[model samples]
Target: MKYKPHEQGFSILEMLVAMSITIGLTGTLFYFFKQSQDSFVVESARTEMNQNFRAALDLMARDIQAAGAGIPMFLGPIASKDGGGTNSNPSLNPPDAILLLYGNSSFSPVTVKAQSSYPAPTSTSSTIYTDIPTTAFAPGNYILYTPAQSLMQASNLTDYAEFSLFNLPSTSAIGTVSSGGTVIGNQLTPSTFSINPSDDNTYWNHTMSFPSSTSLRVVPLDEVIEYAIDTTSSELRRNRNKAGWVTVARNIFNMQVRYQIETYDDSTATYTASWIDQVNQAATNNRALIRSVEVTLFGRTQMSGSGDRQGQRAIAQTLEVAPRNLNLPGFAPNR
Candidate 1:
């Protein structure tokens, strides 16, 4: 076909304009895609962080609640004094005295042993064994006597006003036996022999000798479990059993512990609860009678950025739990 020929190619200016428009459209699409990707990353990191924080807190709370729970053999009575001692009174002398109500330390001198001298007495009076040899005593051993008879005696036959016996050796040294019968030793003597209602220091100390004395002195048994954040590495660490701290989570920003002390008032016949910042220091002495605990954890995203395309997230959680040591009578609200 015979037809007039049109300009075959576009001008240089037309080509340049077309190229610029194509490039602008491609750039806009790429920018939007980048922004969407950043937003997804931030949201995902935030959700994961929140989950981790909650999981940590929940685990802590469950363990705390199980503390000192079940197995009455390990824990003493729930009440401290039971209408026997005043707040000002020394906890060592409670009205109702019981021996080894709470399990002693693994190294405790007191222990329960099989009775070689059997035909176990049916009556309380028949069970009394006077003039018993101290060498025969085992840890956790007990003899039932009318509260009046000599409850305990020293190996040397020295009269102890009131004494408790344990299979464990005395922490203090007063004197030792060489070859002869008796040598002077650093024996802990007590003015009164009775069980302290409180688990405080009044029951545990080097001042009172067990097995040789009847009066109970409060012993200090403090256990610490802490979770801290490391600023340099941005990690979370836990220290339980007080051996040393070890990192548990990287990217954790903060961790905190809160305690609750539950107490009963005999006169009012009611219970009271209070929050404690810490339980081991002198400043928190009153609060140190903690029966429950609450833990809070905070974590952050590992990355940094801005806007939907590049921002990070923070997550936090709180949990509550009860400690085994603080479940004793005077410290527990329900007990």
Candidate 2:
């Protein structure tokens, strides 16, 4: 047969080379696209973890600052456990639990009513009545403040009466506010009421009265706030008083707290603060010595990534917060 240029076709070797070049270009493009997608996903996961860590820390900081608010110095303000407090046999990586005490100043104002036949505070009895339902008092220590009845005219020593709601006639739950605001049965105190007339310098006797009748302000000393991390669930939880635990943040891997103790150097005439773990300070009976707290929270991504790409990455945040009420004069002992 006679071969013509127009009828010519490529040999097998030439066709093979052309196919190889096309495959190489396609493979390179695919590789680049996959890498870009993976990077985007990893970045998104880290952003989510970082947001969760910040939220958890902000919630904790606000509550810590409220310690000892509206309550007398006699009551212990801050306490903490190195390991889990509620969990008896804690896990290998158990997070710390911190206890904070502050008055529920946010609660509705309740007034002492003479119409209910509420008697004046006496050395023998310290019972008082409020116009609101007994449920208004979250069964714990409370202060009866009669601002008009100060110990001295020009002094800051006002007549602040301290009493336990459990000591009242009928208080069922020790630290819960039930429906209808009424105290039903008498339950023993779970937390201590340390402010007594003999010991508490702020305690005094006064026959408080109002315009037409007599009234006194009922301020709660019962709010017990606690924060803990659930390692198993990777969540941060909080409980108020004797209430159930509420989740503050999810995908939280770890939580740690350190307390700051203020020490005054007599020779230097200066105050120096030291940060110590909860275990070391356990021997000291001074919760008031805790001037501030440092909190560290570690969070992890929920999603899992493939080989060489960790779907989960950890992010951490640290914050320091001072309890304003505790730093006030006469709040801390030996100050």
Candidate 3:
């Protein structure tokens, strides 16, 4: 078969042009794929950050709701004492420390059996023997509420006395009652109510005292929860019952809290609300007036991947919670 030069399959120039077009299309596809992958990584990181923040907020909210659940009636529930320096990071900014005290929500209530002791330590006039053995009581802080007279038989509404238990000698000494006429004792010392009428007294007096056979309720000191931010580590941590702090969320940049104070106007028959920081509350000495809290949390994503995929992202979350235990009716202070 005789064929002319014009009838050849493909010239070098034409082949070169086709190859160049193919290479250009392949490069374009690779660029778009890389972009999609980078976008996916960033979006995934953002989602993870959001989820982590939400989980942390839920835990904090639950603890806040139960703050001061079984605290002694005379003691303030929320304490804004600044945990200025932590064991982990001392140079960190004085992040505000919040202490929530509640009773052993798990322990069952034990009853008082005898007024005086039975044998080993012998019964003292101030002893309150319980039906359970001394070993049954867990050695810790406790709240004791006793009524001078039963509700049905009480002529005065203020006949009940609430005592804060302190310096319990041991699990065996649970029956022993503090001195000073059943009033708030030394709190740090162990003693019985003084027989002298002139002694600084609380619930118990010469007339009104915890009577024998009276039903009493006792709850342990607290759960003692604290939330703090470690600026150095960029993390949010929680402290439980002075058991040390544990990290909750990583890459947390900040945690802020604001307290809400509520006041009731009798004449106007209305309630008023105000927001204040811990510093202002300290100046006013109205910590008891705090009714609710607003929390703002900030977090960020860790740098991940390489080159185009390597970058950090940030997120912020906020929430408001009311602690029913702290804002108990007829007990909380005015705003």
Q: Specify the highest-lDDT model's number.
A: 2
Please identify model 1 stretches exceeding 4 Å from their true place: 1-5, 11-17, 66-224, 263-269, 280-288, 307-309, 328-335
Residue 114 in candidate 2, Cα distance off native in Å: 24
What local lDDT score does residue 293 receive in model 3, on the 0 to 100 scale? 81
Q: Write the per-residue lDDT of candidate 2 for residues 1-335, one digit (tens) a residue.
A: 98665746898999999999999999989878877877778788888777777788888888887776755432235666665354432233467777666665565435654543444433223444445444455544554443233111111222122233222323553332223776432222333243221232222111111112244455566576778777789899887754677899899867777787654444566656677656222223234346678888878787767663655676778899987765433334221
> What's the lDDT for residue 295 in model 2?
87
* Stretches > 4 Å off in candidate 2: 1-7, 84-93, 106-219, 265-270, 279-285, 329-335
TM-score of 3: 0.60
TM-score of each: 0.49, 0.61, 0.60
Ranking by lDDT: 2, 3, 1
Model 1, 162: alpha-carbon shift in Å?
A: 22
Number of clashing residue pairs, candidate 1 = 41
**How much lDDT does each candidate structure score?**
0.40, 0.56, 0.55
